[model samples]
Target: MTTLITGATGKTGQRVAHRLQTLDHDVRGVTRHSTPRFDWHDRTTWAGAVDGCESAYLTFQPDLGLPGADEIIGAFAAQAVAAGCTRLVLLSGRGEDGAQRAEQAMTASGAEWTILRSAFFMQNFTEGAFADELAAGSLTMVEHTVAEPFVDADDIAEVAVATLLDKGYVGRVLELTGPQLLTFEEAARAVGGPGVAYLSMPTEDYITVLTEAGLPAADAAGLAYLFEEVLDGRNAYVTQDVETVLGRAARSIDGLAGGEQS
Candidate 1:
């Protein structure tokens, strides 16, 4: 039996698949266009995606906040059950109501579940949303000027891999956060590169910038909602979950921003 990874194209999922493979586990990924196509928007793919799977790393793409995400998750949980998948490691976002809803659905699915609730990823700057802006010498976030302890994608992946491969994580909601919090400017400064400026702007202004950047309106809206509603000091506090799960302190942004001059 294989451990299926959803959203295999994403940063976290990519890391999870690699980690699982490194451990010599039978791992397979679900992608819309892959040999085993796993499109969450297409339920017909779920059965095939979960086929011959004893466990799964479930990461919803676009986001868990999308319309009907909860319903889709619940349905998928049922499919996992029918497919004989006993372990379901769900990737959930901290402070995200939609993720919480999806979590509840997974829990109620009757499978041994592990919810890896994670903080915002630091990869957003290098591999995700802020990558381009960072490259362009401008980075924008919802909060005008507050530090967020962005969790490393590797940390999230390691924790998820552990939960998926080990039984100790069953029924646990491991909330992994970075060791410290830093404002966007602090994070940029920590990048310690030639020069990275972090600016704080109003949520509306941030939304406008995102909209102007060619992101769909809905994505811009959700991002604005995340920044204004969720990231507004709610995630500034650092936690030891990373240390607890990985048996080591979380990696610092400075180390992660490798080769950048402060």
Candidate 2:
């Protein structure tokens, strides 16, 4: 059975594609600019990408919490089902209210659904915004010294591909997280080194740095909003979802960033 994966170039989606292809599955990588072109903003492109596929690994680009994501996800799910897609695995954010709305839309879109709810990814340090900060030897995060159990994209991908390729995982809400919890400073130190320090800057300072670095005003504002809104001491817990799914505990944040062992 062929499976189409949206956002196939992203941190988690790329791993999912690798896992699927390694197993020799007829994996289809869908993007906004593929030969058939599958832009999230265009409902017309999804039909071509999802055509004749029995399953789809749906991961919205930018983010599912972005404006009007629900409408777009709902429309795409409907089209996929109409085009004969049977199962859908939705990658959703953990504890974001908007994400729940989008997940419900997919659930009601006439396709069997499995939602993988995940907290902040550990890859943010090695591959994203935190990368520069780690390299700079300082990380000024707005989190209030709270612990967060970050999940690895590879682990999340393994579970997603398993659910997509192997059956019997329908209607499950797998909340993926790391095996241990680490505060923002601790998390930062793990990636960089003992020289790294986490500074709790004021919201205004945070906005200033983000803006000074040439980030758009809207994106800079959104970055502050994430630390202030979604990460207000609420995402500090460990879970066994990864172990349960992959038959082993999720990798730790420090281990992920640690240099190769001698």
Candidate 3:
């Protein structure tokens, strides 16, 4: 079956695309840089990406927690339905209002949808927004000892591909997480050597650093709130959805850290 993967070059999307392609599935990857670009802000670009695909893995750029994301995702889901796409898999975050709204939109869309509400990714230290800071030998965040069950992106991609190919997970909102909970210091120690420091800074101070590093004000504030508010002992528990969907234990952060690539 033909499948379109939006944000095709991203951490999770790239893994999903590769897994699908290895299985001999016809895959089309769309990015803002693609020939028929799939810019989420441009409606005209949406149709071109959806046209010829029977299934799609949709990952919103920046994040689903951004303002107006609900409306944007809803519009794109409608377009995918009109283009004859039958199955949709949405990547979303847990405990965010906007993500909940976006999930609602996907549910109402005509296509059969699966919502993957994920915890913080372990790959964040190696390949994501936190990589640069970790490489610089220091990562800063708000000083909360609340631990999170950071899941692996590989697990997420596997689940997404499964959702697309299997009918069992349709209409299910899967909460994915790793097998254990870890604090930022513990996580840093897992990824980086002892020399790499995990500094717990004040929320406002961290926001200042983010803005100084060139993130927009809205984004910086959102991140500060995410680290300070959402992470306040809320998502400390682990889930078995990964095991349920993949029929195996969820990959642990320790396993990911000891691998060739972090």
Candidate 4:
């Protein structure tokens, strides 16, 4: 049976697909551009993507915290199960209410599911939304004193691959985090050198900056919400789930910043 991967070209999705392939697992990575053309917004395209797949890795676009995400994810899970894809893995946020709702919906779908409730990704600095700003030598945000134990994307992908292939991890909700917590300013310095500047602005101003920088209005607003509401020190702690799942210590941001990870 095939394993389906949504968001196949995205950060974690790409990594998961590659790792599964390296392990010689049959992988069908689906995106809006794939041969099957799986689109999150277009329910018409879902059946073809889920057909003949025994398992799937789901990473919702925009985010799972958006309104109506629970409904959409629930529907997708039901479709996957009906199509005989019994194993489902979801990429979920750490401390978001909407994410929890989506999780519940997936669980209620009756598929064997594993939820990787992950911390802020370390790759946000190197390869994500903040990459351009960090590359420009300045990173700005709606600054708060809250620290986050940012998990490496590579670690998350490994865990996803493990859980998808191993039924022992079925029905588990693994909270994945790095070994240490770092505030935004500290993270900025770690990613760039000490000369790099970290700037804090009001939430609205930050949203304006992102929109002006060509980010969609909804995406900018979603990012602003995550920074202002979700980054309120609720997820400052680290977890051993990654170590437990992978049988190795989780990668630290320091290692990533030092070019230890390629």
Candidate 5:
């Protein structure tokens, strides 16, 4: 039986799919562009994507933090279970109400489920939203003293693969994070070396900067809210869940930078 991977082209999804393939597991990677297109907005395509798959890794697009994301996730989980998928793993964010709701929805689906409640990804600097600024030798953000225990995408993927294949991890919610916390300025230095500049702006100013750079106004506001509110010291601590699952320490931003900059 094949394992289905939704959002297969995304950061975590792509890593999960590649690792599963490396293990010689049969994987059906689906996106809005795949043979059996799987779109979060289109219910008709879901059944086809879940069909014949014994397990699935679900990554909700835009974000699971959006309103009504739980309903969509709940529906997808139900469909996956009804189609004979016994295992479901969901990628989720920490300390967000919407994410918790989505997790609850997956748990209620009656499938053996594992929720990977992850911290801010270290890859955001290397491959995601902050990549361009970091590459240009400067990074800017809302001014704050809050620190994040950013986890590696590869570590999350390893844990996902473990839970998918091992029934031992069934019904678990793994809180994944790096071994240490770092402020955004510290993170910028780690990724771009000591010469890299870190610029701090007020939350509103940061949102304005984002909007001026072509991000939608609503999207910019959401990002500002995330940095100014959600990330405000609430997630400063580290967790050993990655070490517990992977049998190794979670990769730190400095470690990731070392490897990437080598």
Candidate 6:
């Protein structure tokens, strides 16, 4: 049976596809540029992507926090099921209502589903949105007090691969986080050595920065809201889900600091 991995070129998705291939599973990696052309915006492409795949690793593009994600995810899940994809592992965010709605849709799709509700990714400092900022020797964000348990994309991919292959994880919702929590300042220092500076700006200023960095006004505001609302002492704790699910502790920032990123 083939396992289809959406966002197959992305951080976790790429890692998951490689891991599945090493494990000798039939892996079908789907990207917008793939032969079947699985563009998330084009519903017409979904059936072809799901065709002949017994399981799928579903990572919503941009994010599940974006508008209309629930409908698209729900519809895609239904399409996957109708096309005989029996299992699905959805990569979701920790504290977004939009993410939860998409999770609910996946559960209701009648496919054996596992949800990975992950904390902020460790890759944010290594291979993600903040990588450039950190590399530039200065990391800026909104108010500095909150700590986040930054989960590694590798751990997420491990859990996702296991969920897709193992029947025991069916219908489970695993909340994944790193072994420890760290503030943006600490994370910056860890990722880019002591030379990197961490700057905390006001919400408006941060939004302005994001806008100046090419984010649309609404997108910038949404991120500002996320930083202020979701990251405000809410998801500051750690979880053992990585160990519980994968039989190993989640990778820490220190572990990632010495490794190659996707």
Off by over 4 Å in 2: 211-215, 259-262
Cα RMSD (angstroms) for every candidate in the order listed: 2.5, 2.3, 1.5, 1.1, 1.9, 1.6
lDDT of each: 0.81, 0.82, 0.89, 0.92, 0.89, 0.88
Which one is best on lDDT? 4
lDDT tens readout by residue for model 3, 171-219: 8999999999999888888888778888898889888988999999888
Runs off by more than 4 Å, candidate 4: none
* TM agreement with the true structure for every prediction: 0.92, 0.91, 0.96, 0.97, 0.94, 0.95
Model 1: ten consecutive residues of lowest lDDT: 253-262
Q: Lowest-scoring 10 consecutive residues by lDDT in candidate 5?
A: 253-262
TM-score leader:
4
Model 3: lDDT to the true structure: 0.89
What ranges in model 1 sit over 4 Å off?
192-194, 259-262
lDDT of 2 by residue, 126-158 (tens): 787788878889888774756788888788998
* Model 6's TM-score against the true structure: 0.95
Candidate 6, residues 1-262, lDDT tens digits: the string is: 8999999999899999999999888988999999888988898898889999999999987778767889999999988999999799999988887789989988889999999999988898878889998988999989858899988899999888888888999988889999998888888899899999888988999999999999989888877876777777878888899999888778888978888543
Clashes of each: 9, 0, 0, 0, 0, 0
Which regions of candidate 5 deviate over 4 angstroms?
Answer: 260-262
Model 2 misses residue 128 by how many Å? 1.7
How far does residue 248 in candidate 1 sit from its true spot (Å)?
1.4
Scanning candidate 2 in windows of ten residues, the lowest lDDT window is 253-262
Model 2 / residue 51 / CA error / Å: 1.5
lDDT of 1 at 241: 83
lDDT of 1 by residue, 27-64 (tens): 88878888778888898888888888999999887788
